[model samples]
Target: MTPSLHPTPATHLPLTINDSIVLQSMLGVGAYGSVYKATDSHTGQTYAVKCLSKTGLDSRQRAFQTHESTLHSLVSGHPNVATLHKIVEEDDCLYMVLDCGVEGDLFYTITERGGFVGNDVAIKSIFGQIASAVLHCHSKGVFHRDLKPENIIMFGQSVKLVDFGLATTEQVSSDFGCGSTFYLSPECQGGYVEMVKSYDSAANDVWSLGVILINLVFGRNPWKQACPRDETFSAYILNNDFLQTILPMSTELNEIIKSVFCLNPRKRIPLSDLAKRVQACKQFTTPEFSASFASSSNASAATATIGQSGVAGGTCFVSSAQREDKDQGDSGVDVRSRA
Candidate 1:
């Protein structure tokens, strides 16, 4: 558990960006700052604006904010990752203008769709894009420590990775504070404040990706945490044969799963390697799965709404309910676990 974050004062509430856009309604509040729905007075375009009060943040928190903003500037041009339009600093606060994910996030879509079962095309398309996005980030020397469903936003027909507050450089020490518990890799579990062990951040991303893929397919995480102590994980590690029972789909996909979920970080497949394997999969190459976005009405309402709720630009992914679970823009560390 982490220490509680100090509160941002109300005096900093209403902020204007670039002297053009004015922040309007409160979208949501997370560990880092409060998100607001802002309107561009000139363009009349709406964007999800994140405002961080510098007054209350400690040195570590300030460093995290700087790191996130820097990473965003470096990794903004990718198709699958969210674009950071501009960043502004004024009145002891930081303002970030970003491309809004009008269709909300994947978590809500998953809840509405019931599950990703029988919708292999959507599953493959989403996963493929995510792989490409993560790969692109890695190529740019950025590693997203927290890659979960909530961090993924549906941008028009594509999905973009958001919230780089926990992002780190490609070269990272094994011990770092990042990732949510359910998504943490085996090496990321034990080390917290006192004990700092070394682990691969890239491998950590892949492990989280595997967990997300499983959730999309099966509707729940296979194990609470990816350690030997977890009963389901222990059984699966004892016998890789469980792959047949859990994900009894294409052998190629299954093979990819095994490679990413390897207990040893050294053995885990690199993002580039996994991307190649994913591209080679025949099951995913079928016409239905080849498209980058899911087709509507082919599956359940829960699945259909993922791409249907909104289009490329509109008020998307703004909810207090979801914001409560976020880790204030850092690696999801809070005074106590949200769960």
Candidate 2:
């Protein structure tokens, strides 16, 4: 008998722009907007709709939108990156409908399942996919200012880089000093005036990737030590010294991170070399990893809830319970904008 191909509860129901996409449940909210799983009435395809409230958008948001639009134009067609289906506006509010992948963001995965994946093969596989996406962005003269676990999405074993809100074009010099402060490059923190002229955004992304790789292995931000501090970027650059803690990793992996995270942009490891090194690592050829890396089943029943539960501006994502409650039926339905 052929297997039944019914849509899982996670499928988003369609809605139009201007009309309220039923708030099935909040998927996630960031500084600019909230993302919810919504369906398109016309196509029956699931999409992630990012809703930016007019009330919340300030000058910073304007700059973000401008850069985001530029990056979207540059990288929209690439498969490794999130596909932008449509951009809609209602009054001052802006809604962007993006392709909703089978699995969700990598940060949600790593957060719920403890820190850093233990499977070496899994890490290499995911890393390669992410690198391909990043490399594509680079080829188009776009730099992803923020490249972290929070922005990566996993579908089975494959990964796609999402959240291009911080992406900037290569031709234009970025004036805004934005991105999660933790992932900010040392030069970016030195004030835009000083760093804009010499800022090598490609290298900064490399550094951020290095930080993310460390987090994948250790489960926490490598630069985060002695309780998070509110230090300036320059101060963090001067005092940041966590390289010694990497003694636990294999020497090859350790060297890769070091080279990628080099303080000098010109001297940092190129993506081409990094990709080659990761593939050549001993972990890549191991029998266990080679065989089982992409075979894992998507059986985890945790339904994610994004956006702040109670706080006006706060956002959070949590997994759904194993058994779906009748009252929680709306949790899996998609919410869309009125067309």
Report the C-alpha lDDT of model 2 over 24-121, residue by residue, as the tens digit.
43465454556667765555667777666665567876666656755765687777687777778666666777767655556656666542344666
- State which candidate has the highest lDDT: 1
Root-mean-square deviation of every model? 8.5, 10.9
Worst 10 residues of 1 by lDDT: 330-339
Put down candidate 1 lDDT per residue, 156-179, tens digits, no spaces: 557888888778895545655477
Error of 1 at 24 (Å): 1.5
lDDT of 1: 0.66
TM-score per model over all chains? 0.78, 0.68
Query: How accurate locally is residue 296 in candidate 2, as Cα lDDT from 0 to 100?
Result: 38
What local lDDT score does residue 225 receive in model 2, on the 0 to 100 scale? 18
Q: Which stretches in model 2 have alpha-carbon errors above 4 Å?
A: 1-15, 18-24, 54-66, 114-116, 171-176, 191-197, 225-247, 283-339
